[model samples]
Target: MLTKAGWILSAPASVEDVRLEWEDGSPPGDRFGEAKARARRLLPWRTGAERYPAYSSALVQLAGRSQLYDGDLYRPTAIAGEANGIRLRFTHGRYFEHLDTTEILAYEAASRDLAGRTPADGRYRRWLKDPFDLTRRSTGLGTVTLTIRTAAGSAGFYMHKRDADQLAVGAGVVHAVPAGEFTPSDIGLEAIRADFDLWRTVMREYAEEFLDLEEAYGRGGRPLDYDHDWPFGSLNEARESGGLRLYVLGVGLDVLTWKPELLLVCLIDGAVFDRIFADMVTAGKEGTIIAGPRGNGIPFEFSNISRYVDSENTRGAAKACLTLAWRHRAALGIVSDVDS
Candidate 1:
């Protein structure tokens, strides 16, 4: 088979259902930084920042806005699962270093080491024995959610067209809506403790991507009061009401950067979805909301699933998510109007 490279170790369970465990591990020294430093000494004349100035600046702006925080994010250090349950082990990882190695690859003519390997070839992922290596690189754990609106007999899902200028990876591509890197809602230790949960991270993204709420949630120097906040409060209440259903399909790695993603699906009753997202925006910080027939969600039928899964433009993470969702549609209670 002419196969494409994907997840290094994908379990039968999704990240959400896993019995997750974590170690508050300290920073693993940066492999990319060491390489960059070595390059600075070996061939100081040609530097990444100097050569890729435009791309570097855009990344700089993204980091400056705290969108790419240098703080700790959950790293899936280990995984063990079966048809019954999945147990995942995690550790604290440096958010900045992950971007340094992964996102920086998108820039044209990025750093090439003494051996003449460039970022185009994923030289940053060299430290690990494998592309999904966890040794020196800060392997990130992000979330990708496929939004399905279950409006009684008719059910469909929503997608997003990520803006090219938004970030380095997965940019300018169509992806499932409300996808994001897992991070704390605010700065400091309190947020670190509170936002550590996977569901919290997913809900926060919904607030940001769905409602177009300001991304700077923790700028006020206080942990996000999810119980008191607008979208967060409403989101929690809706979850309790059993109107919104969140499911995780599995996890996968990017063939390019080697980062892992927690693939998820948000199945919401059409009325509940509409009421909660009454003020939903068409486009915001992430990208434009892609609609389906007559501006509704793209049908969740077999044809639409096959169309996206077969399309080259759909992000690989999305393809995996949609493929898995379609496979388990009956389990997820997805009521398709057309053929299965």
Candidate 2:
């Protein structure tokens, strides 16, 4: 189990060993039709706007927005732990469908006192226990990452405090930087089919969150070429050359929102990290970047992790990413990667 994060359904696993695949199709209907109906009635939802007042008002005030298209998303269909590692699958899903489901559920739970207590009288938590539940508790995937910067004799990671006004779940909470929904690069069929890889979503978020670049998926009615894209190309090359490393700590749902999260972390060579994020924006669409350790992140150390992980302000997935990364630092080459 991911101790601090309380991953509902997981054991010890690693990203280097997990195999992932996706197909275009519909997943079974979620079991939350009744729950959604109840939550809406219990909360003060804006009638026609289809959002809670706080979430709706925040979006109206934001100066810049990250995404124009709600678009399609890859819904988790299955996850099987194999002898070698883990196997995960996804299917096609609509954006608004999720907003109307788990998004609203998160707001409902938060509005009540059910934030951390799962299975509270066999309610929302029961539905989320089985991540691959056919009744699909969640329709969207959270590709949240702990962005690590490996420097000479030192290493640390970045943090993002989500805008409570805009985000329904884990609002104003600290999270790993480059966090985003697992979705396709474009709204087209082909893009939906092609952008299922986990790294693609991570890279797109990095380009937007760190560099403040426009969303890197196919823009201008053109297909995105990962090999030629500025940040994606650089990130891929660095990984190939052993200058950057990607690892998956595990997958689970955030207790507050019960939203599925493919918890992950990326370690980058200091030189490469510096170069890529040299012009990093202090603020982006999601919220302000917590500049720390006198730089872009908090120090990835025991004290910092302990304080944050145990705090009520940190998101479950973010804490899980940090806790697992620290526990597996050796296998991840986190410390040695820089000195080497």
Candidate 3:
């Protein structure tokens, strides 16, 4: 079986790693101020429609197969030929809709019926009880799990439980910062030039979560024009200055959703991490960083992330995800051990 973390695209053939620094006119400072201000105005995160909107196109089905290049010979399996997938239209940067439990219930019924008649391994047969993870891991829905690293180490974030979230009400989970669904906006579309790029989703989440630019910009509901020299410039600045290094660590399933999560590790210069961390701490102390409504935002330093997991504060699935990622600390540019 192909290991989930084997499909790392950290360095694609066409990508060149260049050191970038923002000089006189850049987004970090005076150079790209106008553009940053403009892109901030373009955010539409919380404005999702209540009803299911139209997809840009019809769903497309394809054969599903898993592959990994780890210097070992591979043989195709019968399951590879039997499995298939359908591409659902993107959420288009809208807030995540509530997970419809209808699918889970149906899968459970089908699995139970099959289990009664078939002779299968206990592990495979028992999966009917955990329908959420069974569908997530087996069906291959995609997600993005971003691990934020700073000089002090990786940063931890808290998720506020909401109706839309999978966790139970009043529960909290400690997660790597800015983890979210990989959207078409992250990849780019012909109709929307603004969101067209691989880094769009990651950096956009960074801006919204850490920078608080979304609420700040969406405050007045004021309309603003597009500024071409946008998010990319700021990203370039981060990459060039050695403040940020993004890696596609590999793919893994969220234990709860059983969805395919694209593991992305983001390393931030220690100084940059400290600055953001301190600011969030200040925000939390001032009660400016609300924890509810969407899950209050609680920030944790890299050194203390283990507390949540050990204390059982985080959900079981998130705990599994974090534990798996922590095993790759050195690869993710993290220097400390998982427990430390």
Which candidate number would show the highest lDDT if scored against the true structure? Answer: 2
Residue 290, model 2: lDDT of 77
**Quality of model 2 by C-alpha lDDT:** 0.67
Better of 1 and 2 by TM-score: 1
TM-score of candidate 3 against the unseen true structure: 0.46
lDDT of model number 1: 0.67
* lDDT computed for candidate 3: 0.35
Positional deviation of residue 74's Cα in model 1 after best superposition, in angstroms: 2.4
lDDT by residue for model 1 over 1-340, one digit each (tens)?
A: 0122332223234345656776765435535455333222322223555532222344555334334445666766655544554555677665656655444433322445434766445433343446444544555677889988887678888888887776556878888888887777776778767777888888888888888887754444656788988887877887788788777776666655556777788888888878888888868888888767754589888888888888888988888888878777778887876665
Q: 1-340, model 3: which lDDT tens digit per residue? A: 0223223333311112211111221112121222223222322233364221211000011111111111110110001110121112121222111122211222233444576943322332243334322221123223343444444533443442222232221124344445443333322233234432336556655554455444211222332222323443555676777787765444443443334444455666656555544434313211232232222222333444465557554544344445544655655555553444
Candidate 3: count the clashes. 11
Regions more than 4 Å wrong, model 3: 1-98, 101-149, 152-172, 185-196, 215-232, 274-303, 311-321, 337-340
Clashing pairs in 1: none
- Residue 220 in model 2: shift from native, Å? 6.9
Indicate whether candidate 2 or candidate 3 has the larger TM-score.
2
